[model samples]
Target: MSDEGHWFYCLKHMRVEYGPGCPNKDRMGPYDTEDRAKHALEHARERNEAWDAEDADQGS
Candidate 1:
């Protein structure tokens, strides 16, 4: 996606940034909205939990 209107969660600054704030390695995403970018850590945790559950289910 284009980086013009996207938002990102800046890991280094711990804040929501609008359009190309920090380097990609120190940020969460090009989320469509600022609110989504703000919740990046929560989203990541939820996804990780879901993936872990899926892995466990597959193993079982």
Candidate 2:
């Protein structure tokens, strides 16, 4: 994707970055907006929890 107006959560620096700052490996994603990038960790955690719940349901 074009790195024009995307946002990323830098895992190495633990901060939100606009456009391109760090390498792709150290970043969370190309979030659509700055606010979403800022909440990357929270969103990841929530997604993980949901996936875990789905797994549990399947196992039962």
Candidate 3:
């Protein structure tokens, strides 16, 4: 978890569908900073608390 301004994506929408709705593919962050993106990941993780949501990890 390095502080680098990047975007962290997550399939929050899919997580809600029980792995069977709308492709379960989505992105969630346009974080202005890497630190922020990481925060987003944590927030989303807390919200979804699943392995799939964790896969939503991305940097850029």
Candidate 3's residue-wise lDDT over 1-60, tens digit each? 322344444465422221122321365445564465446657776777665556665421
Highest TM-score model number: 2
Candidate 1 Cα errors over 4 Å, as ranges = none
Model 1, residue 51: displacement in angstroms? 0.4
Q: lDDT values of the candidates?
A: 0.91, 0.93, 0.47
Candidate 2 lDDT for residue 16? 94
Candidate 1 lDDT, tens digit per residue, 1-60?
A: 666899999999999999866788999898989899999999999999999999999999
Candidate 2, superposed: residue stretches over 4 Å from native: none
Q: What stretches of model 3 exceed 4 Å from their correct place? A: 1-6, 10-25, 44-60
- Clashing residue pair totals per candidate (backbone < 3 A): 0, 0, 3
Model 2 pairs whose backbones collide: none
lDDT ranking, high to low: 2, 1, 3
Please say which candidate is ahead in lDDT: 1 or 2: 2
TM-score of each: 0.89, 0.93, 0.30
* C-alpha lDDT of residue 33 in model 2: 92
TM-score, structure 2 vs. true? 0.93
